[model samples]
Target: MTTYDFSNQTAIVTGGAQGIGGAITALLASQGARVAIWDMDAALAQETAERVGGGALAVQVDISDWDSVQAAIAKTVEVCGGVEILVNSAGIAGLNAPLADYPVDEFRKIVDINLNGTFLVNKAVVPVMTAKGYGRIVNIASVAGKEGNPNASAYSASKAAVIGLTKSLGKELAGQDISVNCVTPAAARTRIFDQMQQEHIDYMLSKIPRGRFLELDESAAMIAWLVSSENSFTTGATFDLSGGRATY
Candidate 1:
């Protein structure tokens, strides 16, 4: 495992309670960064933070709501001192169904959490980063966003929006020291799989040329670098983690 120095840095990781986010939080903490876990699951967040144990704090947050996000950010800053790094990993994979047959409410919910949520969290954090003139942000997108997945229109669309948001924001902050970027990862077996149907899961697996699901630690390592000061010149770029699933 490559070690990156994060001494004196503070980071906020949404969805840090589990899955890829949990892995990220742990790595960041081990690298000497004070981490704040922003997640909806209070107990899980606290547990993960404790497990990380290097001044890791857990704050309940619903990234989809403006008020909720605002409160969470304030709380995180209050606890961790300031925000220098952010990893937007909190999101949901909506039900799989044909476009015409997709549930309207479900589609809206998916967008609300996956797309709008990223915007809200980014909006809340940019000013703080701007004031300091230094920061690193990594938004978690999906390969489905780049290459639309069958029967997963809502999820795909929401992730596509995330990619767009990351690009736009990265460019906006390019002149500054703050670097904002996103990653398009192929399917990884996480708790998120519980929300998806078996057919949908199998369909995603079939697309991965690697013939295996991505591990949480692999994604975490990539993200850890992206958020590190070492990744200075690459902003507004979408790093690929799709195992040959994305062409272009």
Candidate 2:
């Protein structure tokens, strides 16, 4: 029953070709916002963009690379006339293994894509928002960032860094009418689940008091509101979507 009028805004969702990102893209577009999807998957990204209607465009970009992210942002700005909202949803799953058995390279790769990519996108896009003095940003983090899932040390650490970045940047832009926030969602029924082991899956489910996987659309609903004008009072906070798993 939540209704929002975003007919005047332009929103960019990174990694918005599939899964939770695809859900977020469709939701925002339905609300009448000009949506641009940034993803590495060209065909799927283009397909989502088409489904979102006219004024929606898809650009292929690797978020982990700063130059690619910047280029995509520039393209989005050009297409949309200006960037008003951003949802950082692009990320790779980490190697689900113990620290001792974990390859250092794999760990670093997760950090680079999940953490550094989030940072670069924000840096590249914030300038436009700062110039306009109006913006809303939602960085998609995970519950692992908060409670630190045992085997997913890399993912947990990367998401934890996202939380830190959200708070820091939210504070920096709080006075400028731009709100920066992040969400800590529990195990979503997405491709990321396939990246985890059976034991890790069982371990995660046991921790969730609600005992159900989060729906992609449910998470999309939050991201849409945060990107909408209706979410106008909160900033620098970690909103929970943990199925009652998160105690703090």
Candidate 3:
């Protein structure tokens, strides 16, 4: 039996209260990392952090707001010592509708959280990682970004932006040992599903050739590797976890 050990590392997972983020948080904690969760939902975040154990904790944060994000990062650093791996998994699935029918405000909100949120968290952590000359970042993208979903225009575009940000940041930090990567997962049976109708769920499933929904464990497995010291020499690349749905 083998395991991925993240001992001696401090990790931070945004939206770590639930879904794939929750799984990642727990797994990392189990592997001996100090896991600190950042989420807008205070109670849920604390609950997940407690479940992770191993000196884990949760902080209420809105990643889109730099001020809020900055304070959250500060508190986590105080508790975890310093962040070694950062996973930008805080995101939202907006109302599914045609681009024409999408509300402008809603679109902006998605961008602010999905795209800008990633930026804020990275901005706050990169300098610390760079100084240490060792860091790993795994951002959560989407298969919809690869092959745009019909009614999820905002989501698709925001994820695409995340991929682009990963590429640019990876290059900027190429001189250092820090590597940046993103994962594009197909529609999974996450809490976001509750926001969608059955018709939409059926449509999403139809796109998955594997005929099954993505499990959070699967996503967490990939992310853990990306953040591990084992993931050397592979930066600025997007990992596709689309269950055979993504041709790219």
Candidate 4:
């Protein structure tokens, strides 16, 4: 595997306890970065930190809540000194149903965690990056956001908004050394699939031209680069990981 120097850096991976987030947490720590796994699951986060075995820190956080996000960052800063990299991998995939039949509360909950949560985490981290004038941010968007998956309106819409938010923030911080970008990945077989129906999962699989689901390690590879100093020029951009599904 290709590697980058993250020895002196500290990274915060929201939803870092498992799934794609867990893959990233392991990879970053393996590269010598002091990583902080921020997740809503305190026990799992601590377990992930322990398993990674690089002095990784775990802090429970509800990314959708401002107060909780604020406290998470404060604790992270106090413990890790400062954050040089951020990967917003925390999100949810709401139930699969047509927009007309979707539950009102479920839709709202999806947006609250996926879209608004991204905004809050980015808002909390930008200033810290600005203070040091060096940072790399990678928000995990979905291919559903770009292509608009059927029966997954809430997830698609919220992720689409994440793409938009990344662009706007990237431009706002372009003058600094910090880079803000997002990735639009096709579905990976993670716990997020537990929330999806079998039919919905099949539908997503059929849409991928590669005829297979995305792998967590594949995503971690792309994201690891995005959050590395090597990704110095790209910001406000969307990197596609759809395995031939993305035309643009």
Top candidate by lDDT: 4
Q: How many residue pairs of model 3 clash at the backbone?
A: 0
Each prediction's total of clashing residue pairs, residues at least 3 apart in sequence or on different chains, is 0, 0, 0, 0
- TM-score of each predicted structure versus truth: 0.99, 0.97, 0.98, 0.99
- 2 or 3: which has the higher lDDT? 3
Candidate 3 on 80-185: residue-level lDDT in tens?
A: 7888999989999888999999999999999999999999999999988988899999999999888888888999899999999999999999889999999999
Q: lDDT per residue, candidate 1, 1-248, as tens digits?
A: 88999989999999999999999999999999999999999999999988999989999989999999999988877887789999999999988889999999999999999999999999999998999999999999999999999999999999999999999998899999999999999989899999999988998999999999999999999999999999999999999999988996
The residue ranges of model 1 lying beyond 4 angstroms of the native Cα positions read: none
Worst 10 residues of 2 by lDDT: 1-10
**Tens digits of per-residue lDDT for model 4, 67-110:** 99999999999988999999999999989999999999999999
Taken over the whole model, the C-alpha lDDT of each candidate is 0.93, 0.89, 0.91, 0.95
| Candidate 4 lDDT (Cα, 0 to 1) | 0.95
Off by over 4 Å in 2: none
Error of 1 at 215 (Å): 0.7
Q: What lDDT tens digits, residue by residue, belong to model 2 across residues 64-162?
A: 898898889888887788989999999988778988899999999999999999999999999999999899999999998999999788999999999
Which stretches of candidate 3 lie above 4 Å from their native place? none
